[model samples]
Target: MAAAGPGSAEGTTGQSALAAHLAFRSAIGDVSGSTRRLSGELSRLEASTPGIAGRASGLFVRYVDHGVLQLRWMDAELAAATQLANAASEVKDPDMQLALLRRAGPRLQAAMMGSLLLAVWLDFLHLTDVALKQHIYSVEWLFVDLDRVQKMLKPAMTALSSGESGQVEAVARDIPALVGHLTREFAATREAMRAGAEKLQKILVLKESIEAITLLSALKFSLPSLPPSAPALLGMSLTVGGDGVMMGTRLVVSAEWVEMMRHLVRAGVLSLPTVSAAVRIQAGQVMMAQSHDELPKGVCDALGDGPEVQGMHVTGRAGAGMNEPPRHHILPKEFREWFEKRGFTGEMDIDQFCVKMEQANHEAIHGGGNWKLGRTWPGEWNRMILEALQKAETRTGRMLTRNEILDIVAERMEEYYIPLKFIPWRGP
Candidate 1:
């Protein structure tokens, strides 16, 4: 039943990797597949940056690190996109599926956004490298680049945070143009540096100090005249595979909705970080909406009057829960089987499991203590809750409260960027 999503093994049949790649490209409307190409380029750049050293190398290093983080965030968002796709796939309602995909639009847009910053960073680094090589490094130029980058960063962040897919997509689409401009400039500079280095070779003299300043070993400037240990720099190295590979391998999502379903099979393979609790919570809400009307009487009986769906939002809507018939707590056999499948083989009956979960949740929220899952593995708790919901849906033919699902999943929300673990600027 759940095999309908993009990543499901059932869909892997006779389709070639190239065909699958094309299918995915079209489903998300990314015709150029620019983001994936950029990701591969960034991977190459990341490998080449470490040995570079000059007056502004520290800043360049930070840029590389920041690029990596952005990619990591993109990877996290990809997982979320997959989940959104999968949830949409599992349901029978077209309207609901569209709603889920619409919600997914912003995240998909955000996933391709890392390259924008990477491009800006590359431009700044190239300029700085040129200044250092030409012995014209200036402090004012540093701040100018910083200002320009920061200005661009704000809008990019806004796009990332926004749910407006069209807006985000526009921002992402503009990246390739900037990449083209910077790439041409980069090629010109590299050539000039190479020619200049060849001229200097005749009169070259190795010296420890350029003037009054004693050159430190760590501050060696990468000269353009020298053969690159690696191939080309970031901009010039963006060339993808051979012509045939590029032609046969072009990603194109079909116009048909059936093709879209084929691309969603592998959704939700990536694990979300603690900071993505909101996404998880939101997903839970969406899932609940799907099963709400179809919930079985027996499953309702199991949860009792106050089912206490974890992560469920508290609303003041009049007669929300009050109008419903009194709920009774009873563990059904199907619920037991579901837990067993998840490796919850202890003697704790269904009622005991519910009580423990509710009690742990109560203590965390109301006990004025450090809020944690109070379990050895918080992930286990989350898995149980989602699994239980799935079981309930199967037994009762209805979705449960997704907000409450968040209550369980939201047990541990972490910051997306931890200051202490970030760039060297954060300090050890």
Candidate 2:
């Protein structure tokens, strides 16, 4: 066969690039539709069963909104890539055409990163759906049992008042049995719900980690080699403009991403193995182990006294051969007056609303990190919690109850990838 000229090769490469772009755009559209549908479903679930559904439904909706924003950015980049590809095709000089196509490489890579992020998010949504459904079922069953017990109570009281010995005796026996059954069921359901919530939190951390990786990848922070078990790059050719520049399919592990992952691993957000396993889970190549129920060591260390206020201790007390993490005020101490005005008064000592945390995690939350993250994530979390509190008070037209405030704190912690165990426990 005669050798293909540069012009002919350029034309063929451009065509393949266009085809890949179109396929990716189609995939984005599909994911966008799915995200919108899931958001709507979650909204409905949140509205209908606000009490039982808790915050997961609403949190997912917010997550979907964030994902959609990412998709919009992706679409813009893809459009740019398509335009550049077309421009390359119109150029007569092979060198000029090649240069134009080369310019599209980064754009295409960005779009690909967005696609990967959306795919991971969609997997998270599926997992959230399952967990939320289970939670709803468990709470609903508890309500049903409560109603049944209430009905039984009235008749039992009547038999006792009427002095019907045999009836009272039988009724007493049945009541104890029912109460015992209810207790056991409630404990089981409560434990299941807790586990589900913890699972969702860990998965949320994984999702955020993947998002960070994708962003880093788009910024060209990647190794020439791929990571272990990394999936194929959707069978798309990354080479463009007749130059052998590989723009995609490399493992993205920027120094910043690596540092953040190291911090997370050390802080017990998720273990290193869990991170790898979770990625595989998103790729549909593996399942999470059921036996992984214990809180991360960092979390356990933070929850030292088990979320209870067992009297006040020194903020950063270290024991022999042990480094004690510093205690962080869940509601910042500087905002103690503000929280008190919003009903942290009386028995609600803001000082008691604290959790132990590794120094790095604590510093990060307080805006001590990379300038970009410090400006955004930490500030965003603070704003979110404050806004949530303000909105709740506005809706109820009153200061939040103690439990209500605790619930808000807990929800925000989960949303921001903080350990739920950090919230002060107030009994079951």
Candidate 3:
């Protein structure tokens, strides 16, 4: 599995998150390895440039400081998962503990994806300078491969459940090898950075600036064992040409790339419907119903994530209905720390908690975008990203501090997602 952060979940979500966090941490570990290597290489690449180091100082900082956070977030996730897993081992219930462990895979996958996209955004805007891009491309090209192996996990899991341990082991073994490459490449990158003593001249007389928009295309494979749209949900696609050596001297991101991107937007938007919000709303309604009386098997199957639903149970004890005031209303200090995340106090209070949680549940398992992001984007994620860029004055050589960068990432996340929501959990 690729590295991921805690993903779109926090607190004691459940058993699956345990595995997810493990996978997530693994991915983040790679991010660190890659970032360190890239930095070392960039340092070498700029060694001979007369003014480039000072010119690109802020860019380098962004790559290093910002990149390191990916690893930290992964650590946070692993910590959270470890806590949950340990707690789960104490549950003493045979079936339930195993079920919890099983859920870890999906959560782990979601976390890995969120980290990748975050990396993409960071790299895309890091420093559009050529050597920097080359350094980034060479190192990050590996991050993209995490998806290939993770995709296989589902098939392996399906096979494992249906009596195919050999297949599961085959895929599981592939994960470490792929992940190790990320580490090994970074070590090599570090060496490359140290070894390169000469710098190339800036010869742009023959090359033009890259095209702004390029098309990224991908191939879709449908498998019968998983959900019908699973492949599409996993975001498998090929990034075809939009680049080439125009005069054997310069590279270009062409108009053709823009057209391809446009096609993707058209196809994706037309073919797929946004399901996260709907799922949350539906799940919330079911929880409300179940709290009232006996929930049907179908409803239980859909909304029976006993762990997430138990937040109310944590505060008010199990069997407490929406109408009842919570008996134990202690929101974690961390939860209360978010600037916009106000404490729970019972205005639809627990009434809507289940709905808020429902979205995350679907996102983790079915590969929904809401949960995949890992960041709780407010309504202004895009605006914040631009604002950060502007504040950095990256083009002008000014840069934000580490706190400022994290603030931007946080604020941008808000713009990317929905209103504040909650789900309390207790796990191993």
Candidate 4:
């Protein structure tokens, strides 16, 4: 009989996550290796201009940062998997294994998604390098490949996390097919870049050739995975024309490109804590471009001052629904400290707690938005605050006096709502 592979996933979630992590680490190793090598080569090469050199150096920094992050995540996943495997060795019960697997479902999903995206990003970097060296604009075609890979894997990611053994197996069976497609597409992209570079070299004038190099430098700053509509996100079909020699360099930003960027930020891929700081800073640039004046007349006409064009600076959607809460939330450090100080030793599920806070904020605004510090707390607001405090105390074996609870609620409101002057009500 053949030896079982890590992907066999015949056991529980921990086993499945371990299997997925190992497989992804192995698969991503090649891409990571290439990026490491190229980054070194780029660092050593002396660019013709300081500008070009700066851009090359920037790409190298990103290459190093991304590689480090990928390895860190892989190591953490391995540690978790190994620890679980050891514990599972002692527990003979199948039910216990299943429970462990369920516990691991989230990490497994993240491992698979992160690995697949990293591979795609590495290929994108390689393509960008070739485009600069050859002065041919063939990198756009690679987005089609990236788009296909993202679409293919997203469904698998969903299924693996669904907690059904059969579904996970079904998804696992598709990995080889997925890998095959990615390999084929990347191979095709490299070949195209090589051929395009060779052919373009023959016909390019000196100025146009130099322009290609410059364009490549600009492209390096565009992380293939950062934007929402990034080819890695949903896939992209970009049109390219006008070599700097024949035409005045046309790089048309399409509607799809704009939409992709929105998707990327909204999805929180750009907001990974390690990367979110830089991406969020640039996020305003993206949002600013969507403003009525900056957008194309056609897009502006279609949107007509709509929220899509206006953009939501604040985090939530308008109106009420169980699903209307923000998609992502990070707890304020002060609030966490207050909780800890009160002896709440429970797992701090920031996301769930943020939802409750948001709902409370929403109600406060709805209740005439009359929330002011040192004033009588609204009935509904008081009820929600007490419930949250009681739940936390129950979970953590901590007790908070009524006054303490009120103080916490007051502090929370001051930070989250007072600045906005939560009074939505205005006299006519």
Model 3 residue 407 CA deviation (Å) reads: 41
Cα error of candidate 1 at position 242, Å: 16
**lDDT tens digits by residue: candidate 4, 232-251:** 32222122233110111323
Best-fitting candidate, scored by lDDT: 2
Give per-residue lDDT, candidate 4, residue 139: 32
Record all residue pairs in model 4 with backbone atoms less than 3 Å apart, i.e. clashing. 13-101, 14-101, 228-260, 228-261, 228-264, 229-260, 229-261
Among all candidates shown, the one with the greatest TM-score: 1
Clash count per candidate: 35, 0, 31, 7
- C-alpha TM-scores of all predictions: 0.36, 0.27, 0.26, 0.29
Q: How do the residues 154-217 of candidate 2 rate in per-residue lDDT, one tens digit apiece?
A: 4543443332223323332233233333334333443454565566565454345334433423
User: What's the C-alpha lDDT at position 387 in model 2?
Assistant: 73
Better of 1 and 3 by lDDT: 1
What is the Cα-based lDDT of residue 294 in candidate 1? Answer: 28
Candidate 4 global CA lDDT score: 0.37
- CA lDDT, candidate 3, residue 301: 26
Determine which window of 10 residues in candidate 3 has minimal summed lDDT: 214-223
lDDT of each: 0.36, 0.42, 0.30, 0.37
- lDDT by residue (1-428, candidate 3, tens digit) is 65334442322333343433343334335434544544454444345232223354333444334334443544444344344334335443322233233323223332333233233323222222333433432334333332333343334333323212123223322322222323333334323332331233222310221122101100001001123344443232112233411212222223332232222112211000111111111222211112222222222223232543322121121211234222211121233233123222322122212213344433442234453352444322233344454656565475443234333433333443422222233222
Model 4 residue runs over 4 Å out of place are 1-79, 89-121, 138-167, 200-428
TM-score of 3: 0.26
